[model samples]
Target: MSDPNANRGLAGIVAAESALSFIDGAEGRLSYRGYDIHALARHAGYLEAVYLLWYDALPSAMELAVFEGTLAGQRELPAAVLEVLGRLPDASTPMAALRTAVSVLGQVDPEAEDISHEADLRKAGRLVAQLPTVIASFDRIRRGLEPVAPDPELGHAANFLFMRTGQAPGPTAARALDTSLLLYLEHGLNASTFTARVVASTLADIHSAVTAAVSALKGPLHGGANEKAMEMLLDIGSTEAAASYVDKALAEKRKIMGFGHRVYRTEDPRATHLRRLAEELSVESADTRWFELSRAVERLMLERKGLHCNVDFYCATVYHALDLPVDLFTPLFAMGRTAGWAAHVMEQHMHNRLIRPRAEYTGELDRPWVPIDRR
Candidate 1:
């Protein structure tokens, strides 16, 4: 029994006006700043997507080139930040490590206290540039391997992969990852984006707002869904088992990871692109197991439950085909989402307002307490 009158999760409430991204969940479409997401995911580079989200317009060719140089220039992490990453316990989750690393980055940044639009924009670019480095370095460090330095000549996705394995990614792999990052560039008022806006509403620095976003994304119902979804795929093991697993999981009243979204009434528009990318990568690697199994589950879920795959569904297989660890999936999410988080933070700062929502009281309205002697 629930109160029908109450807006239980603030599900339908419009919190603010934003021009960053738009979603027509009923139509299964998404766009950022008037650009179709399908177009961006298919053709735009991640850096280009970052520029679009931040600048409110698609950059001209020369602008994109200069933007690339500017963001790529900031890819190196502070040495103290590197030291912190190196000392974090091997058991540290990428999400936790990244959150801590971002906080440290703020302390080292001289402009961290500056919340002006110009300073925030610069900080945003720096964060987006450094996120992959932080995650890749942490991965290599925890594995007792020397971190490979960032390659300035490499594109964002390729540089991230290169920094991890000390090998430049091939065109196809790099494009797949770039497309995935572009697809994740923005979504309308998602948990992490909302968290970022809320913190920014208080006039917090970009780094502090982003750190809070990373923390919000650590929750399983949010960014961690892809990691859990991938683990579920691993547990299912093969295509033959996917249907039975889904059926059994449903019958037993268990939650299926990556099957639905909070906002989308139809399929997640981004999932379609990811499904294609996953298949391409799996075929390229001659490892079609995860991709095939993902399709099996996807079809079965649609047939049985009428639910659609969110952006995170096929993304599990896509990341696996790219050789990313399950645990790194969420941080990779945080990495891609940095663009949107920063954009939202800047937007909130531009229109400064503290986001204080009221809560309804459900307990007894009046109660009396006696003194200790009244026992």
Candidate 2:
């Protein structure tokens, strides 16, 4: 064991490097591949960003068509995978179901373990393209309804919303969801991606790496914060309730979910975009009550803890407006992040090196063990 003051969380540690995305926490800037996040979120669609992340450049018109065609083609889940999904409990969390499904998929695909550039890229594309469909399918099946098939005519973000609700999404909602996906798509060595790289460094298959990443993401401090944020909103009934409730929670030293971050001391850049989306969606839906409550909490949190809301804060409101369940928030994160996970897996494999880190020992050394009977 290391010393109690060793900072076991790896806080302030530089673990890895990447050229895919850059986050300057001090400057509050985020970029994907080479594109500015604000511009990409505002203008480029989700599929367009995914193409850039996976291929390392923006796609031309012809390339975009072929890329989207490939994604549309792979949208359908295997019947065997669907059969397994049907057996899962309805109350089962979507993230758990997603982890199981991704693992099960590895069993069904002969090339699931392939990590070659040519082979893995194809596999990555399929997984990335199918993520939204897979998440939607699990959500529908568990609710005792047939999964809605993906609509080829729909754009990536719009198709996902349509799959969940079986209706065309409004332009504003569609854009909000698309931007959210882009925001969550990639980050530098987050817990889940680190888990993925560690597994891939062992020469494990991409499916195994992704499965590990999913498991890491199940933690509350990570991908599950959005769900908790919604819960916090429901707990505090209104804007009036938010002020007192926040005070009590802070007095108890409880972490205000959707606020603060490990890396970004000022504010999460993604949160700025999501906050704008939440604010817009609130106006667009004419449901400003939740928005009011959220803002009240944000103001109090800043005053009390000097902490501001992260992406998960307003994202909860955005998802709520779209009628998504609270529990599905993190799974939605996983769906958006599948592309990044795959990209990270490819990066780890390209310059394949086993990721082995040393721990500073603090335990008793060379102690003789007493026989159990001696006790």
Which candidate wins on lDDT? 1
What tens-digit string does per-residue lDDT give for candidate 1 at 282-345?
Answer: 8888888889899999999899999998999888888898899899999989999998999999
Summarize candidate 2's per-residue lDDT along 276-375 as a digit string, tens digits: 8888998987889998888899889899889878888988988988889998899888888888998888888898889889877767889889999996
* Candidate 1, position 310, lDDT: 94
Clashes of each: 0, 0
Best by TM-score: 1
Candidate 1 vs. true structure, TM-score:
0.97
Candidate 1 residue 146 Cα shift, in angstroms, is: 1.3
Model 2 scores a C-alpha lDDT of 0.86
| Pairs of residues clashing in candidate 2 | none
